[model samples]
Target: MTAETNEVKQTTKGADAVDEAIAQGIDFDGSPIPPAKLELYHKVMALEANRQRSGVSNTMRSRIVRIGAKHIPQAELDKMLIDAGFAPLKDKEAAFFYGGK
Candidate 1:
């Protein structure tokens, strides 16, 4: 198979493994989703709901950006920034000083 195809297969396998583990009740080493996290999720959902009610676009990228701006995951934040026509930087130094790179 081509390299691209192999990479896709590997990613699919990894996702499947994760799904299977979850289905089998395998608990990965991490704290449970905290109340603050849930609150953030709710806040994001509420924002989306407001946008939808106001006939605005409810794009996932926009939602992610809004959430990320509130200090969500870096990778997710980077993706949101990219989707919003901003560059995704590798580190805080780049994001702060260079405005993403």
Candidate 2:
């Protein structure tokens, strides 16, 4: 919450009444994913679902790391992909974002 990067953030617990049911996580119908992971999930899903609509993957990961929450470790990105319904398409991707078991 710095002055420069000020943005409204929604918590999974205490959002507005409209978000009460969803709890502010990435809501895929009724499933609630954490905000950090869910943010990436939405973007990945969107890219896959409508590839022509978004030419963003080339720089998407770098941009996300720059703008996304500082607490979301880079390692979590791959799992976020999996949870969002896919796996990293390349070894470089896996090396960068793979979450250890």
Candidate 3:
């Protein structure tokens, strides 16, 4: 198989493995998921899936801010947001996400 085909197969296999584990209520470490916790998670996710969205850009920005703060330096993340034409990090976000970093 071509490299791209091999990569796709590997990714499919990985996703299938994860889906199977989830369906079996098994965590990656092989522990059984708590039924209550899983039920709550499913309920919340169902609600979120049905919720109306403002726009794709708004969602993108929110995700970038939420996740990027955990991995990127504050200054870099702010620059990236601005460079991408999104709002720079707000004072609250800066304080909350990068406070002790």
Candidate 4:
């Protein structure tokens, strides 16, 4: 794999490694890192912080569904939602009106 992908995978898998890499001033690639990539990394770190703060288990799925019934004729999304502890949309209108709420 490329260094960028390796860096991203390592960052995701090991926080300590990411910190060590940062402390060592190791760049993901030979090029200078862009501000946008740093911003995205910070956002991911913030998300991790928020996840810890909320005491929300990462294994628990959110009780929000986005797929409308009409768009998904097989009802697979509904079944998945129900299995994930989310209420299925009863109708297309209701699904569209409150989808993701």
lDDT, each prediction: 0.53, 0.48, 0.83, 0.55
Query: Which tens-of-lDDT digit does each residue in 1-101 have in candidate 3?
Result: 67744543454444277666567677655568899978997898899999999999999999999989988999999999999999999999999999977
* C-alpha RMSD by candidate, in order: 11.1, 14.0, 6.3, 8.2
Error of 2 at 83 (Å): 3.5
Model 3, CA-based lDDT: 0.83
True lDDT of residue 75, candidate 1: 65
lDDT (Cα, tens digit) per residue for candidate 2, span 1-101: 55322222232234253344334553524455677776686677778777553445645645454333244555575466456554433565445444352
Superposed Cα deviation of residue 100, candidate 2 (Å)? 18
TM-score of each: 0.26, 0.23, 0.75, 0.31
RMSD of 4: 8.2
Full candidate order by TM-score, most accurate first: 3, 4, 1, 2
Task: Count backbone overlaps in model 2.
Answer: 0
Query: Model 3 reaches what TM-score against the true structure?
Result: 0.75
In angstroms, give how far residue 54 of model 1 lies from its true place.
9.4
Note the residue pairs that clash in candidate 3.
none
Deviation of model 3 at 50, angstroms? 1.6
Best of the candidates, lDDT: 3
